[model samples]
Target: MAAKGLILLLFFSGLVSSNVEKTIFLAPEAREIAHDAVLLGRRLPVLTPSNWSLRTKIDAEFPTEGSSQGKVSWFFLDNLTEYQRYEVRICWAATQPTAFTLKTYEPSVAWEQPDLRASIERFVPNSQQQDIRTGVAEPTSDQPRISSALVLQVSAAADYFTKNATLMSNVPLVDVDVVLDPYILNVFPRSLLPNAACIVLVAIGSFFVSRWVIALIDGLLRADAALEKKQQ
Candidate 1:
């Protein structure tokens, strides 16, 4: 029973240790924006890495469909960071291909428009997934301009490419997630050594504890046998 309790305690500890900060958005599958651009609702402001550690995740609040499920959002993310190794993952439930475009920009004070520095585009097929990761290796450069587009089948159906028109979606829901600290930490082997050590220590401790209990039982049995002899 004690061993069963210890196992249950360890299982619960793993669950508690694995929780992450989650922020959800009822992001549009598609929306027309300024300059005939397609965006996934408003800009998302992301905040992170205050102490050189950044972990964020964007995913559907649940597997449900339609707009009624999630919180209505504008500029969905609250902040974004640069000069860090990060990953941007977009997952959806549609069977049609979704055009995922990431546009990067440098803000300008004049309000004319932010300068579009770089644009990354991918046509994700069968609505599988589009994962964008920066710093694939050691020496990595900055990634992304800012906004995103999860254009679901609209471009496939209409002239969204040439018209530069913002459009809506036929599909139900989409989510963007940013949380991946555990994966990033594992990239460096040293980050995992301490956790491995802790597991070994626990196993060793449990073995020693069981041995002590067994020895105590044996000693008590021998003493009872001696007492029986004396009684005889």
Candidate 2:
């Protein structure tokens, strides 16, 4: 269904006219994925001038209805290539009781239930979730990119049949920000020299400031000792 939606989106996007202009979320960092929904959150504080590699964001809507287990959403990190690195982040919104579990593997691998969760689910402030979610999917080794499909499912102790199901079904929207932040390997040293120089200067300044502080404290102690000896 998600694939089908993308097909329709590709064909009809920019072709249709609306009474009011709809908001289009472009993968700003990852322009290769020119079309997609940009979730509310920043991937990193640092900025990149070039498109050496950018994190991919895929917009997905978690189903309000699912098996007794709760709502589930499936997504694929399809916009990947060989010889690349990324920091993938998947973000979702749900209540405290509703625990999210992720299952992912390379498409080439056998379709078996993963023994362990690829990442852990966390519920933080929406403001922080975007950034916190950034760390959810850490870079797996410094190796190049490998494509995979990720399945996120919500589960809780309360049953959907029960009247007081305080999670998943109640709050089904999940923000999957499978963002891939690239490493310095691809970036030219010249491009980074400016920031690197600034960092070096800051470190040197801090070093001198700390030494001066230490000398000041030492002088004060020596003066106090000398005064005490003279008084004696």
Candidate 3:
């Protein structure tokens, strides 16, 4: 269903939409990344930028919905060549539980290369496997902008690498997995350092000013009373 929605979006827009005019709860860094993705989406021929919005459809993880597991995954197979290196980055919204897992799948021996029609089925997450590696957590939220990341070093087998040593060595692969919170992107940290310094100064100033104002008012009232008694 998620795939279908993405396809429909591509089809309707003809891959020429100016911007995805939608809001979601994303962390500051994630929000910036998302904006960059949208900008890239507007320019790129492929669907790298709009991937996060599509994943939000699966569950509630955007600005509107605050709960549930929202997921987004992308593959870089379309542009892969026999003598090329690749890097992939994946980002998603963070959820309440805060648990994250990453799984890596390698290509099979029978997977043929050099054929233009060849399909790369190398990235399939194993659902039956109980043990999935835990990802490193990078909390980006002060309130709810927390996110996580996992770096995946993807390459062909040793035999394949030996055969194409020149091709593999020339290019490096980088993959980024980020789960973001759309709501907390703009939330400021509530710490008592430099941020609180301004507030604290303002508070002290207000406190003295208020005290002086009240004292003046009280003094005026007492003076008025004394004048009234003298007249009496």
Lowest summed-lDDT stretch of 10 residues in model 1? 151-160
Better of 2 and 3 by TM-score: 2
Candidate 2 TM-score to native: 0.35
* C-alpha-based local distance difference test score of model 2: 0.36
Give the whole-model CA lDDT for all candidates, comma-separated: 0.32, 0.36, 0.29
Candidate 3: clashing residue pairs, number: 14
Worst window of 10 by summed lDDT in candidate 3: 55-64
| Model 1, CA-based lDDT | 0.32
lDDT tens digits, residues 1-232, model 3?
A: 9999999988877544231111122211221223222221222112122232112111112211421222322221111122222223233222211122223222121122222112122122321131122222223443332112111212221111335566445422212232221221234322224656888999999999999999999999999999999999
lDDT of 3 at 228: 100
Model 1: runs farther than 4 Å from truth?
1-53, 57-192
What is the per-residue lDDT of model 1 for residues 105-167, given as tens digits with 9 covering 90 to 100? 222211233322111122212122423222212212233233332211111111122232322
Judged by lDDT, which candidate is best? 2
Cα lDDT of model 2 by residue, 107-153, tens digit: 22312323222212122133244442323333434444323222222
Q: Give all candidate RMSDs, comma-separated.
A: 15.3, 18.7, 21.8
